[model samples]
Target: MKIRKIAFLITFLFLWRGVMAQENSSSLAFSAYTDVYYSYFSNEMEPNALQPFTTVSPRSERFGLNVAQIGLAYDSQFVRANLILHWGDIAKATWSEEYNNVQEANLGFKLANGWWIDAGFFATHIGTESFLPKNDFLSSTAVATYNEPFYQAGAKLTYEGSDDFYTEFWVLNGYNRFLDNNNAKSIGVLFSYNFSENTSLTYTNLLGTESAEGSAVKQYRIYQNLYLNTVLTERLILIVGGDVGTQSNSKLPNMEETAIMYNALTTLRYLFTDKWSVTGRAEVFNDRHGFISGLIPTQNSGMQGLELWGLTLGIEYKPDPNSYIRGEARFLDLDDNAALFSGSYSRHKRWELMVTMGYQLDRVFGF
Candidate 1:
């Protein structure tokens, strides 16, 4: 009788364990997405040291397949993690012709009391997307800038208590602008407040040092970005914002001042249909002071100060929840005394036409 009772208890516990496992499997969720791009860029004049002219062609240099990032993420009430993999060399070559063996990865978790923590390699959460504004195209904008483009490995934490407010802080492997595993490191903090459903504001700060050519220099950089968003009606959305940044401690062989670069942009988006949308933007930039030795000063003999303006008009079409295509025409004009163009001595301007196709995957390998 005693032996039989023990056997019955064991069987009951085994059945209970099996049921719990099945329930856990049902609650787990997984998702993934990928984006492939081809880019062609051209400038009126050849590039200089600040902006190198390494492309073989003048009017158009077709940089190979930019990159297709495969993202895998898994989530549950208690934990989560994300992984991003790329096509290696093709992506590395486009970043810098010298470096190889490149990949990006990130890992994150949730803590008690609405605390979120993450660590690994990732891009800074800065600015709105330059194109395809509706999609969460965070990393893509980094690609267009060609600066701080890839993931910087480190740790980040966030506190999101309510729908109206949140704050985040991060320490990263400083602006690996292009490649990875450089000795530079930095720290950043961002605070945000959502005024309403259609409006939000953000403040950010970053500080670090960078290595260039054959030497390394310490740098103190500060930036503040303000974003104002509103829904004009059921069909229109507007976002007006600007950024001001100043950098000190550059390694320029001969110079005494830090440079100040700032930009302002106004963007408008209108939805004509559920699948079609129209967008426009006007942006201006100023680079009056060149990065001198340890001080901030005006430019030298040539057009030292640069001022440029950009205008963009585009249409976005979303065929499904997972895919989108967009076409845009960009026009740029530099000030008569700006260093980017020689319009003061000659009559010339630079322009570009771009088209983008992006896709988001819902599942990978039926997982």
Candidate 2:
């Protein structure tokens, strides 16, 4: 009798465990990825030296870790949540002075008629390049660095309508501020239209006040972005993006004029084989008021507008679905008399070469 009772108890527990596992299978998931790279700059900077307007490869001529992220997500019929942890230079640049390493922490719930609302820190919807290098076309564009917002802490309401249209409305802290920089809040909206499986267009706009509390000057920033993606052939794709922005009450002391900046870029990507591809990009960025680039006028140079143009060519080789190797060469040309490119003296051109390796692990422990 004792042996039979023990057997029955063990069998009951095993069945219960199986039931629980089945129930959780559809509700939880895990994912992670790592990106490491070595980069060399032709400017002759030391390893680990600071490179202006560059984030992923800030330190030239060195091996560096770009980003490593781990994420866990939960989804159900009515509710969903995601938590992502980040490490390496991507985190440092994304957060800046903020100490938190959380890349995304959001909670959402489904509403009626294909609507959903989410609240928390989320990646910005304004840029074509993602914080993760693997998701980007080449390394990154200069426009992505100087002109785009990295992340926003906010709440958003999204609607997925018929006919391949989608929209989002957002309310949030000041631009790029994980924590509120001031009492003022920002507002933004995004619209996307998918013409077909091969083509799409998106527009994003944001208006916000970034001034500190009790400051004499009230600074406001208005930003706009437009992006287009098209597949010209089964193996060829193209992307074009542009940005226009202005900030009132420039931080350049006693300057009350609106500072205007604009950037535009186009990228072409072609796949030669299932595992090999090439990408090229051309970009132009202009900081008309010396406000956007934040390069203060030196006594010799005075306060002059700054203009930059860049060209990038990269090749990628994927060994498997989960890993890849990429090599890229970038050339940058600046306006004459702009010393921002080379620290020692004013130069018109610069070059960078980089190689990256990436791997991803998804659903490692769950269905």
- Per-candidate clashes come to 7, 0
Q: What's the CA error at residue 178 for candidate 2, in Å?
A: 0.6
Task: Supply the TM-score for candidate 2.
Answer: 0.87
Q: Candidate 1, after superposition: displacement of residue 312 in Å?
A: 0.4
Task: Look at candidate 1 and tell me the lDDT of residue 275.
Answer: 88
Best by TM-score, which number?
2
Q: Write out the backbone clash pairs for model 2.
A: none
Write model 2 residue lDDT over 205-273, tens digit each, in one string. 889997898899888999888999999999999999888888998734547878878888899999999
Q: Relative to the unseen true structure, what is the C-alpha lDDT of residue 141 in candidate 1, on a scale of 0 to 100?
A: 28
- Models, CA RMSD each: 6.3, 5.7
Off by over 4 Å in 1: 1-66, 87-103, 130-150, 176-184, 211-217, 250-254, 290-306, 338-348, 364-367
State the TM-score for model 1.
Answer: 0.71
